[model samples]
Target: MTNRKIVSPSDMAFSYMGRIDFSKPDSPLFIYAGSMVSTKFTGTSVGMMIFPHLIYKVTWIGVIVDGIQYKFDLNHSDTPVYIPIIDGLDEGEHTVTIYKRTAGSHHYFNFCGLMIDENAEVRPENHEYDMNIEVYGDSVSSGEVVEAVNYCEHTDPAHISQFDNSWFAYSLQLARKLNARINCNAQGGISLINGAGYFDNYIGMETVYKQMGYEPHFELTEWDFSRYTPDYVIIALGQNDANPDPKRIYEKEYREKWKSVYKNMVLDLNEKYGGKARFIVITTVLMHEPTWDDALDEIVNELAMDNVKRFKFRRNGAATPGHPRIPEQTEMADELFGFITGWES
Candidate 1:
């Protein structure tokens, strides 16, 4: 089936479900990578930090994996987008096709790109281990809002490309400081399971942990991670699932289910890597709800056993409107870096 045109938020949420197969060598899937920022239109609402409409241009890009043309959400005025991959196609050749269109009014930022290895391995042979790092999580992990895209209204077009060779993004910035290559697979607004949480919500730690082994449904070639291993795997999920909606409140049973999901996800990772890899879990900084934060703290405490460690992050003052901004991202990276290099002394 031809890919449907996605216009609404709900449609964007489940758009990954519709795709063609591109795993065969002859067939390649297309995906929308990178991001375009939008300037504040006269009547539009102010965008979120990760999706600020003032400093960035309105851009659209994509790539194909396995035969499916996976698209990114460019009209991210409300929340972030999560592009799903197949069950196990991480060991092959893949190509990405981008449709970059930027307006003259705003500077832009690219959403985190899809990262992969030859076959799901962490570090590849002869590949620099210290030079490679894999980041997994939601928008915050991908460097959501670096500037206001709409500030350039009615101005000359900004000289911005999605891959403008910059690392203002906290994840990429952190990678750069370490002199490591970044495999940033963090999507915006992703949940623990495929479709288990609300949009713009905190995705649980378990969900991201399970993402490392996922295969794209339409891969043009095989890609595997077995050949590549990162010295560190940073996980910055769990803000999107903290909402107190009537249907998703954390009751006793719900809490148990959440704990189970978190436990199993970590266990699976340990089993896959045989406890050789280090896992870091981070709490939400933009999260304002007390109940939600408390519950997450408890869950993090539970997941803190064995080889997994928990990193407590406070809300950064640089939140634009409501969500965390670039300042928060920088702070978060600083926190993680301290944990990494013993710089606290």
Candidate 2:
């Protein structure tokens, strides 16, 4: 049978708890948070029309069909690329879900639509969740280099592209445990004040947080805060701000500036979303910077926002050369889950 069937975005169920531009229904924008597409279909093959960004784009997406995971690279493609989902499945109803495994800094993808076996019958499935969460941070939150077997295995950019799995990240893991939809606004080497030393000319999280997409080349689509409100907002930052060296430990001025920026960020978020969501600020897991921890405490106390709280991840051995691996990510997720549940109870 000819596999020439095409399905519109409207025909498939989409569950993304982030800001998406659906102005053009034909090409829905997918940013952070694992945007999911689910449909029950009778087909032997399935495909997707994906438009990747041209620069600063490195997206790792996973297509889960019937519980199996398949990862793909959606980056640097100017035109829409036709991605093969899978072939040779039994002729019956099957479910498929496509989720972003990379963070927002890598950029976003424009999902044009889907194509399947010409004879198959496809219909949307309801995959919505009752609760919503959002996570904002740097590499640790993005699940960067999480799959590296050992420190020696993490060498260069290629390794990051291969091992990074946002699906396994702490934010997503916690969301899954709570049965909540998540929005992940994280990048590999991002900070709030200064850019992480790893990347040259890197933009900080505070600056990029307002823009629609990560890369500068992409058309600016200012995020519409009204799109999806989260019940919980987890801020996993400070590591990048500390970057190559712990500025909070050695530089008093830098420490004060960090505190100021964090205070402003929290206040801004509280002002815009305070009425709807509770805020949880977190410290880095790689390094134990007491000054940074103190700074976070000060921010919370200064804000005195009844809904805001603070948490810290106990330092763990590096998962890779400089990033957290699967085990560390799992621990972080567990800690977060316990904290959130404890508060809710």
For residues 1-345, write the lDDT of model 2, one tens digit per residue.
Answer: 264777787664544345566877888877764555567777778878888763444556778898899987776777888888888898888888777666655657777777888877777666667688888887778777777746532543455366778777887788888888877787777777755434336677777677666654456567777676789998877766656676444677876777787777777776777477899988656654566677788888888877999887655323334566677778889988898899999
Candidate 1 has an lDDT of 0.42
Clashes of each: 84, 1
Best by TM-score: 2
Off by over 4 Å in 2: 54-60, 73-76, 104-107, 151-160, 194-200, 248-250, 316-321
lDDT of 1 by residue, 1-345 (tens): 022121221112112210112233121222211222111111111111122222343443333433354434454454444443333444344333222222112222223322232222111123242545566665555444434344211221343334221134566667756766555655555555434444332334353343321222221232344544666666665555554343453588875676567667666655666666666666446643455445555766777665566666554322333334445556767777777665223
What RMSD does each model have against the real structure? 14.9, 3.0
Give me candidate 2's TM-score against the actual structure.
0.87
Candidate 1's C-alpha runs over 4 A off are 1-131, 149-166, 193-195, 199-223, 243-249, 303-306, 314-321, 343-345
